[model samples]
Target: MNKKLLAGLISALLAHAAHAFDPFQIKDIRVEGIQRTEAGTVFSYLPVKVGDTMNDEKAAAAIKALFATGFFKDVRLEIDGQILVVVLEERPAIASLEFTGLKAFKPEDLKKSLRDVGLAESRIFDRAVVERAEQELKRQYLAQGHYAVQVTTTITPLERNRVGVNFSVNEGDIAKIKQINIIGAGAMSEADLLDLMVLRTSGWLTWYTKNDQYSKQKLSGDLETLRSHYLDRGYLEFNIDSTQVSISPDKQDIYITINLTEGERYTVSSVKLAGQMLLPEEELTKLVQVVPGEVFSREKMADTTKAISERLGNEGYAFANVNAAPELNKEKRQVAFTVFIDPGRRVYVRRINVSGNTRSRDEVIRREMRQVEGAWYDGEKINKSRTRVDRLGYFDEVTVETPAVAGATDQVDMEVKVKEKPTGNIMLGAGFSSAEKFTLSGSVQQQNLFGSGKHIGVQVSTSKSNQVYSLSHTDPYFTVDGVSQGFDIYTRKTDTSTLAVGSFGSDSAGGGVRWGLPIAEDDYLNVGLSIDRTTLKTDANSPLRYRNYVTTFGARSNTLLTTLGWQKDARDSLLVTTKGSLRRAVLEVSLPGSTATYVRATYQHQHFFPLDRRLTLAVNGEVGVASSYGNKDLPFFKNFYAGGIGSVRGFDSGSLGPRDTALNEAIGGDKRLIGNAELLFPVPGMGRDNSMRLSVFMDAGNVWGYDSKFSLGSLRYSGGVALAWNSPMGPLKFSYANPFNKKAEDKVQRLQFQMGSVF
Candidate 1:
């Protein structure tokens, strides 16, 4: 035989002989069939060595060790005289991985998951791993309601003991819910019960909302919703027996059946207080929300308990626990409740530690914290702090954990962890409205300036009607007492022609210094002083209204402006809110240094109510009046204008009030009144998406000259569909309206849209 062939033959034959042969002193050891793996790796796992006696037990140990490493497909040990030979068939290394026809998930996402399962590129290939990966991929597709999804994995051998793993995926259509049947619902209509749930059968809006899609989590939530629906309607013993979700064999449809038992409806007979009522019983009883002779409501019971606990907490009972115990009178179908209060020790905060702020300064988060170290641990304050931080828009998530400190009985530490979010934005966007054909706008804003709680922004906007440039900076904590200082410099020019006003324009340049003092937890008082020069320019085509205004107020006027404003924002969220009220009032006075002397005051109030988890009702109103302070005519340029998305959507922006003769253009007016009502709801397909919302709104308001009488009958009425989306490019809005009631001269702007801030 050839020497090289003989050596190979000898190694293979002896590799298996050692396991069956008697004991022998091993003089040398040789390994075979290694392609890319280091030889030392194999030797490290091998039990037998050069000086060891190669017996059946040792050979068995060597085989076990090699196979356990998962780097080899097969191994054999043999002994040639005193020399041990190891024969190995290495597992194929994954030289590459590819996916074909994958759409439901990104290729990188699948690869990342594969890496976690030890099945990525350059990893040893195992049959079990391949099967597991296939199953895992199938599971992921199923979770997305793609029951018909098919995943097939193929291992193709390659050169150098490597293999290419290819995953071929056919992501099928999402399984849609065909029907939902709620069984054993008594004392309630099916429509009423179903209305309380988010899941529904396929409907016209399913393509956008996707509430018709099958989701295990959605079903779970729906079941809970059903329970609450019955419980809140006086079904004291509401019980959800079972929920069955079935998918079609071909996987295009899903059917859900929820079994529930709505017990006898009960009414509230009485509410009594029990168990350690530290305060007067009358005070505690006043906190009860459940009304006698009204339907028994679990929601009211929970609210009553929460109110009692919160009341006790306000009195320094930080660890208070309140419970509601119900006593049922079966014959009368009435329930009586007793509230029990447990006021635990008054605990003070030991420490307020903050973490997870890698970029934001510690002070930035601490300033928003309402709870302080060494202060009483008030639950309301802690929760307020969490919400305050969330409202800053500087963090994606904020969490507060109150864990009791060790070696202390009445103290706990507040651990506030915040996941910071990007506060820098570069906005370059455009939008269109019927009034303003196409407007372009851009801005560079940094809300968290240099990890400090400051806002700095520069915005420039240009359109057919208006052009503006503004720069502003605000330090939220300019003073230790939470005073905010800011300044703005801006130049603006507005052409009235595009707005159907006069063929005239006005140019203004100015800057202002402002300071705001935090008067209350959610209130601020602002004072500002500004200087501006207004140059009113007119062509020969200028309307009589504009020419008369310039003749009275002077074409070129310099004014010293003073502003006083107050705001109380108790809204839970700056965007997409359901509760609370926001009230703002501002008064601006053009002082004696200029040709124009006027005082303008505007007050706006907005309130929101959550009709349900998915629906909210909002009402907003604004009233404004401006007049000359010292018997001077109000500046026409500073007049308040109504109409548009913020006023009345159906009318062209600023085109609803007093019109100039001959030009037939709205020149604005000194008095304005606006009111809006909106029913906000979630858009289809976007589940629990707070970033986008759709609303049906009614807008009623108009601008009136100080001489014109303000009457409700004169207000134009319009109802429209509006959308607000906090999209990646910035905030976007769209509206379509029909002026159900309109004057013949009112500018009709039926369609409007905006991207980013138009002002």
Candidate 2:
């Protein structure tokens, strides 16, 4: 249609202006002035062929077609004695595009953005398109709060009818919000309302959150939050009338004003159940959160609807619809909500499809699933399955969806998609510290061995005080009933002769077989048995306590060890935990047949409470006790030790225990107690980044020997600040602490750091 319209205009121009001539029959067609366009290409666009009668209309159409190709800047037609001639001047093509002062964005991204706007290298250059490209660059800067951004486009002619385009940008400072005014907020304090918004005036943390920057997207979200805040507080008729954002003359300061009408608060008069009461009305009534005489809350109303929907979903109604219909009385300032539920067709899972397991086997992920195919659709089971798969630690992400089967109303397909991560790790580390002197360690482990959901690891370490070599393997699903089995073999040599501990050395070798039984969701019962032989080595410099033990128990002894443990973990994440509790208890016993018989038990409980979106309160407690059995004494080596990173900071590792007064060396103890409280938050100047966190912590712990009296006053206390980073290699932690009750004999290390694991 555009071609025909252009043709009619061209025909009128030809008749009234130059090239006005009588219709003639063409003998041959010839093209001229085309530098790159082919003659055949021109001929194809021409409506009139060599044999067609040449008229004003056909001539106009031919010229219009050639011009519409966008290849030529100027097109003309002439006749040389009935041999029609077409003349063309091709448009200059873009040879290259370059950007200057591109710090806010990548050059490639800008190039792609220009390409999307029809301005790229090797493409025909149009002045209008270049102008649009300039506007696009400015728009990009504006979105980033760069209101004073300047963009200048330059076109440089090149050889062969080509051009080079350069976009010079000067991105100015980001416009920061200097003030936020909430007009017509009567029920709540304006400051309180602003506190609920993400966008805010410049403050201490704004440098990290960038909440002071003027952003349309942030403003929209803030508005929604403001609305929700009011609605959730019983303001049923709340409305945001207008929002005004203005910038200063220099464009460096932005001011935002939100005008909203906060209607009268309303109370719930009654709550009723209506529509398709598939379940007992009395049972469904328990799901209603709103009660009579209570303030009306949209959050409670929504929760009620969601609960009803999930309950129906558990009954195979996969597409249930639940809504809360509210009736308001302006005179009484009261509202009543009637929860309506629609239970759609009963559906069962037809098939469970697993995808995105590039390295892991299908069954490796499938075995974690609790939702069974051919069973009724159960929302709880499906959610549990997703959580279990995620807890495998083999995938970066796991998602599950149940979509109705095509052409089958009663059936749905369960789609479980997972994004796998590197499940194998190899670490080699060397460190030189004043306390440990020189140490070297290395480990190679494959958590998902050969995509079989098995684990295998080999570890080796050498240091001035200790040397260890170990091998371990685990099959998570040794049995189809979700029982796990593993085995470990290791040899360790400890030389405390030069250290703070009692000057004694010991060499040991051990092997163990362990099994885990899943007692319930998130709970496991572990049992293991192992046998080891140890040879104690001591010299004259050794503490009298250690030498006496060696003389009494003999230099060499063999012991059979057995372990039983129970664990329950309900954390939201294995790493970056913000909520839930982890409780574990383990008991270790040397059997009666062993050279030394003893029982050691330890219990730990750690809980994380989310104070808000950005803060968490974590508290951890641990207790350990050891006792002799069968008329035997507990081995000194088996004594519990506390202090340092995993216990109390500001104290040396294994230094907070009973000490041999003659040698002034800690000898560990049979009783241990530790407690920690921490406030965890994001690292300052790194908003919303979960990869790192900062914590302020208080630690208290102590250890007591078998003959020593356990007293709370003996406990040591410390306060410190710590930083944890989830780096590319592993989790890294650093801490600085000051002991509150430091004794002259106590060993203190004010600063400590470690990598590759969390304390």
Candidate 3:
């Protein structure tokens, strides 16, 4: 009874207090309902202090200021006796974020996109904002042709009032372009109209650039290009009337319809040149591809303008401008163009700046540069520098920019930037055929030795028939004028089949020096000389020297080499190369310090054609004829032989052309001819260009007898398939071959593999 009476009394006193207390009259203030906010922060924004009066208006102002901080969900104020209290409910902070079922983009990429829109992993998460972000993500997916994408978001509360969010997504199929229609196009065929567009269905190169994949961004760019193409072609009133993109019933195919208004086709009646006459007027006129009385083609006009500008540039007018103005003759349905020229101050290169070569030495690039500091600027030289840098194969990207020097009207600075790529290579290889069981070879090479643009390498090879060790070095710019100098030291032991004997083993050591001088940009003249001593040893099983004759003989020889060759490289890369060369050498073989002479002449031709973007067809033919006219005789090692992976596949190593009864191998003849053809194509589904390739090849070659005649019937034919791979360890290759014209007793060669081979 007493508790009830007290409760009644308290209620009565609270009612009385509510009516009597004045918020404006409170002199002190405090805070309440704050879970994470500091009391001092709330008090700092309040109007009432320890000795000041407080009212509902001042409390409302404090509420607004505190709310402006964006930290609270709810705020209120109240007064009790002589004190005012502020209240706040803090918002939850984000703890974590996760995504699922996302295939079109990497997780980190999507996270970055979200962070760009103020949605990160560890910040406050709002329900309304999250819904907006989901809508945006859906729109992005749809733009990329994932029309059936689904996205769901969930939020879970964690300790300390934090919330964790997860976005589950399902990215569906990418919509394909079924058809593209151009409507209401005048003066252009439908096929031609479509040819001006970029978006298309997937084709052979689709896996390379992915340009055929449908995307809103790419479509928008294509539309812009169409608009510009028309506008620049004198279609002043052209417009895109309407564009509609529709999806098939299955939603897998898309059709685009574009309606255009091609206003009119204008003709050029007269063309006048106003550019600075750095050259004769007649010479400059020859550079203009735009002629009067021809239909105005924007592409041709642009080419003409660029040609004019480049002509001036070649004459040291580096900053020349040629603007073409179109004068319309409406009555005559014709237009006249006047090319105005503004040649800015002529400039010279004050300095050539090289950068991004943290490893390559400075002299390497400087030696290749055709341009020099303090010389008149030449656009051709600059372009050549870019090409030279690209050909080095050590850089992924190379760019040259000319930055003008302030306050120096006649001087400019050239900056070259390069991105380095890997250049070192190692090779492990093996091969086998019917004659030789197995051959093992390996090599380690650095094309750009210490980034000095020199090549140094060592190779070792061993087989049942041959063993070799070689070291070589090449200085590409030996004479500072782009001459090339090379040196090679090698030693080898090999078993050979001789004409009179069956098989024999020989050991030899030799070294040679060679030099190449550029006769023209794409032509070179090479000369080399070598001297070696060889010792031949015969075994008891030999056919000729079994019992009655000495088994060993020694010979020393000096040789002279000369060659004149021309090369043309318009191919996109060395992998698809075409080359030809002719060489003549005079060799002398005798006892050490004796005089002997022999001469040989050889010629070769090769061609490569790209059957399609993915395949290349290559053909090569070579012929060599030699005569031993002087007192000296030709060295047996200098003879020509065919029938191996490097020659005619399908047969044993050194087992083609002619046979030596004792050595049981082919000893080459004096005159030889060989020809080969191959078709190389790429395989699918590999990540990079270094994928495996397939090849079909044919080879035919033979050697003539010393006193017999050469006949086409003697040519041996072989066909086979090969596997090629541009491996990081070098070009790995393998092949299996069968001779088309084999006897019943002859066995086909086994499968063979090789590495670090040029062919």
Each candidate: RMSD? 4.2, 5.0, 9.0
Model 1 lDDT tens row, 1-759: 211122222234466635335577879888888887788998888877778876556666777788889998888665556667787898889899899998878999998887877788888988898888888889888888889998888889899989999999999899989888889976887876676667887777677667887878888887887788778889888898888889888889999888888889999999888888788889988889999999987888998998999888766677788998889998999999877788888888988999999989998889888888898878789888998888888999999998888998788899999998899999876876666778898999999988997999999888898899999999989998889999999999988776655577889999999999989988999999999988998876887877887877679988999999999998877777989999999999988867889999999999999998789999999999988877778878888888787889988887888887677778788999999999999776455666789999999999998788788888888998999988765788899989988877778889877665433
Ten contiguous residues with the weakest lDDT in model 1: 1-10
Model 2 spans > 4 angstroms off: 1-88, 203-205, 420-450, 456-472, 487-513, 529-542, 551-560, 590-597, 610-616, 628-632, 649-652, 679-698, 708-759
* Model 2 agreement with the true structure over 312-365: per-residue lDDT tens digits: 888899999988888899999999877777898999999999999999999898
Q: Give the worst 10-residue stretch by lDDT in candidate 3.
A: 1-10
Error of 3 at 691 (Å): 11
* Regions of candidate 1 where Cα sits further than 4 Å from its true position: 1-30, 46-59, 80-84, 314-318, 611-615, 679-698, 706-759
TM-score of each: 0.90, 0.84, 0.65
Instruction: lDDT for model 1, please.
Output: 0.84
lDDT ranking, high to low: 2, 1, 3
Candidate 2 local Cα displacement, residue 197, angstroms: 3.4
Q: Write the per-residue lDDT of candidate 3 for residues 1-759, one digit (tens) a residue.
A: 111111112224444535223445656676777756678877776656787665444555566677777777877665555666665677787788788898888778777777777678666667776887788788778777787788999988988878888899988787777788889877768775565556766666555545455776777777777776775576656788888988887677888888988887687888888856667788878877778887777777888889888777766678988889989887777889998877777888899999998888888877778778988888888788888877877788899998899988888898988887777778777665445457788888888899988998899998877799999998888888988999989998887442222466778788877788777554666766665546566665554422222322233333443333334434455653423222332333222342334566666666677664356787878887765645445545566776667778887655565555544555567788889999877654231243567889998887775666778887888999988867655676688887888644233564766664321
Q: In model 2, what lDDT does residue 445 have?
A: 95
> Which residue pairs collide in model 2, if any?
none
Please report the candidate that would top lDDT against the real structure: 2
